[model samples]
Target chain A: MKGLAELGEFGLIDHIRARFPQPVAPELGIGDDAALLSPSAGRQVVVSTDLLAEGVHFDPGFGPARLLGRKSLAVNLSDLASMGAIPRWFFLSLAIPAGFSLETIEGFLDGLAEQAAEHNCILAGGDTCGSKGGLTISVTIMGEQRPELILKRSGAQPGDDVWVSGSLGDSALGLKLLMEGVRLGGAHDPLLLRQLDPTPRCELGLKLAEAGLVNAMIDISDGLLADLGHICEQSVCGAEILLGQLPLSPALYTCSSKQPVFPWPLVISGGEDYELCFTAPRCNREAIQKISKTAGIPLTVVGKVTNSRQVQAILPDGTNFQPSASGYTHF
Target chain B: MKGLAELGEFGLIDHIRARFPQPVAPELGIGDDAALLSPSAGRQVVVSTDLLAEGVHFDPGFGPARLLGRKSLAVNLSDLASMGAIPRWFFLSLAIPAGFSLETIEGFLDGLAEQAAEHNCILAGGDTCGSKGGLTISVTIMGEQRPELILKRSGAQPGDDVWVSGSLGDSALGLKLLMEGVRLGGAHDPLLLRQLDPTPRCELGLKLAEAGLVNAMIDISDGLLADLGHICEQSVCGAEILLGQLPLSPALYTCSSKQPVFPWPLVISGGEDYELCFTAPRCNREAIQKISKTAGIPLTVVGKVTNSRQVQAILPDGTNFQPSASGYTHF
Candidate 1:
């Protein structure tokens, strides 16, 4: 807690384990050399990783460690949701800058525990060190799903319905307010909540997977249109979206309040919105509605997959529009 | 190779895989989210992680990426050897500073592949990213052995004979030559190779484990005295080692051109000597010799364990002493 070297390797691990949910994996957790988790039946494993750097992905001045931890774990889980897998274990390797306090690490772990418990997952193992400056958190998540039901970005077919769960763009709007020196101050804005703690569409993913309805899936981390493009590229298909029907938080308009910035910017290019963007065949449309009903998530028909290998956006007047940059790039 | 964003995630991974060995562990290898490796039967897994910061661990001015990769993998493998575990799987996560050349990344991966092939180990799964500044490499390794045969730093009993493989101080001396503008040309001086590419004692470890001769095991990562002191503190025992018996490469004296300058400083305080420091019960004295003979590694007896729980260096006259400053500390 005081100095990383002072705790030594095993002592430091014990210190960290005290703050996390003891990974329920049977064979080994932190004491031994490696962890062991049995594979689930009729399922193939799914994995994904994300690295979050201080000062880039987050600003310590306003982005507290808890929120950073929450967001870090959420992003990886969202990836698993894209594959319709059940996230069960995580390995976190954290590099803390010297300026960071033990309290900061604890706050991060606290958020990790809270979010992990929501989906019955646990922190299985990790490596920690003191960096020269600025913190870095790298997390790798392991999940599993039935082979037939495993959703992939490359599985979307022509004529499939493009769908998304719950709301979008709120997280982007929240960032705009933060940049504009708008203090949330406990304001009644779902946009602020979305930014601080965007929910992973785990329930909806499981519901759809169980019902065997979705064709292909991806988490909307890099905004809607850009991610949709990725799905189209992988699936060898194209898509067309009715942009006028883009979902947005009413609170976004209320907060932006006559700033002609066009809500489309937030609705389309907003990253960190961990909602599921998926494609479903027309035959499964009713089943998808039932998934939304069962999971209590709003499933909106956003677009349709097309035969042509190009993505086009249409206005209410059937006008096509083009945007220069597509999505987030972590270079 | 270039910017990770430019290569795209899958492209970068493909580039890496093209260079590394295809894993024989058919169950888990690259391309998956996480790898699943079967540990040796009846053996408990021994796990350890090490972080190599660009500035802290290597000086790019003199450090080759291939050597860095090999050394990074070797350090983790060294930890496994210290625990008498048969090194098996490695998970590497690297963060390279932006604009780092493709040649540099390729060179590093080449070095990693060379070591993996030599050690009979597999590269499982890992994450790669572009950092804001310096590169940071983190490796987690898993080794397995019979649960009861697995050695620990806390298992040495009083009167056990202390032993070490290979030599001490050579790698540190090699590093000094590399950094201090003393390059010996024409593939001479094995010391330089030891410094740049420290060979892990994984084979020696398996021999010791199979022979059931080791009582305690540790890799001499920090100076010999500092590392042995760890065993003393954890096992609640003491050691009295003859200072003059420390191993030194003839090349060191040949390179330095000095009358040893108190060999204790080089042997007791120098670091990066990836040799195995361990203890074996006095009854297995002959077994230790047989292990060394069969494994083709010299095993030099250095000291004996005691009930005192204090570590003392035996002067030529057999008087006891201790080093002034211990070992490496990152914090």
Candidate 2:
């Protein structure tokens, strides 16, 4: 394989464009000075950006370039989902090491295009540069929504029902399994799969927003306690979590059974699930449940908003529980 | 005095927000799930992202974090300037080391705010993470322009006159001076200032686009020859450069006079100038000249579009000259 330096910057960009042709051509995308985006009339754009640095975010020994690229965009898309916005366009800025192989770069971009196609998101424009440090992938995603349909964290009120879509702690367990050198044969391992590629709940979010079933929402990138805390802080309320009501996959339960203390820390404080934690009026529980079934996503009632100002966890036996680890933090 | 990790993610974000408050507040900037942008009706949004990696893009000894932050945003703004777009909102993703001080981060954010206020660009959203490598700043800027007035690289005609705003090669000379450990005392040094903070010709670009004088446009970041090559390639045309007519800053000319040979390569192929290189019909020359004066930017006629499909540079003695180097490339 030819080294990256041989192709130079423009040549590498041409190679990338050839490998990842846009399914839906942007008004102005690659090969131009800047990308052009025309928003629908009366639509408000939702924008978010995330940066993933090597060593800090992932271990190269476990994460391949292709999966890394897919996960990077997936994380940003998750932010859009949290806001109840439809994923539309994205921009990528890559800082690749000098000696990195062109083949690896191709694989990364191919994965990005694959993910973009699946979500109908267009890769608008990006910049690539050589890095003296480890590889860094920065992605900015732009989503669109009607102003009235936008979900925010400050909308939750006391007496609202707290719900989370999908199971929690799976991704955190997946990371642990990877660290322990436990490979259950490629993507067949549910834990490893969750860690490497968690799907963003874009459809479910949009449905909830359109139906007005949810008042406040956020994606669970951090652990349940910390993320729920954000809603609590913004909504000016508290929350109470019933430990027995937490939605956990059987695989995670089985993995926890083998541990000495049943891994409650991972269950409560795990990060990167990319599931929605939302609050809605308690009176609309039945409607919310119906919508959950229609969306084919299990909506678990984990807790409820309270007048108290602290988040509390209650064990199965009615004993108070407090988590040891809060959530993931960059700083 | 606290390290970044000590402040935690949310705390650090709060600190950053306090220091870099947006003067022109975005509709829903920062906090919450994502930033909100409401584009004016009938306008197209222009988007561009650029990444600057330490060691590869800049040397730590010469590139301070404050200047680097300003330059990072400036580079992305240049892309918008080339498209004749009005700077609107920006997103920044930073990868900093764990032990990085809050003071240094403050300085960087301060510099960013300074530049954003000058252009009326709002800092809408950003992500910060720990890095194992040197600091990296990735910026994505969104601009707005009416569809008809948008400039593109593929609109040059066969008989269009080529013009470059401001002098070329000053940035290259600045880099040379830095490498030689030459400093003329702070911002007073024209060469140093050019290298550290080259101005993007936004006003001139908007004027040309609105007046419908320029047929094609691009920013000269990757040197005159290579950037001009992009326009020629896109427009499916050729260009002829009269080397004698090339605009050179007095500082650059003085620096070249002391060299073994005139530094034509720097003037023709050096990168990071951030000046506008454009093409217009011969009939619009007077209008362009008048607008350039009003904008207070010198518009130099250095070349013209030709029927041939190659970019040719002619020497003062009427001989063809091919550049030994064609610009900087990451690879």
Best by TM-score: 2
Ten contiguous residues with the weakest lDDT in model 2 chain B: B18-27
Fnat by candidate, in order:
0.13, 0.95
DockQ scores of the candidates: 0.25, 0.84
In candidate 1, the residue pairs with backbone N, CA or C atoms under 3 Å apart (3 or more residues apart, or in different chains) clash, namely A33-B47, A47-B33, B43-B145, B43-B146
lDDT of 2: 0.87
For every candidate in turn, the CA RMSD to the true structure comes to: 4.2, 1.8
Compose the digit string of candidate 2's lDDT tens values, residues A138-227. Answer: 999999999889998888898998999999999999999899897657543898878887888999998899999898999999888888
What lDDT does candidate 2 reach at residue B79? Answer: 94
Model 1 lDDT, residue B310, Cα: 83
Tens-place lDDT per residue, model 1, B223-245, is 88888888888788999888767
Q: State the lDDT of candidate 2 residue by residue for B105-141, as single tens digits.
A: 8778877888887888888889988889988989999
Given candidate 1, what's the lDDT at residue A81? 80
i-RMSD of model 2 (Å, 1 decimal): 1.1
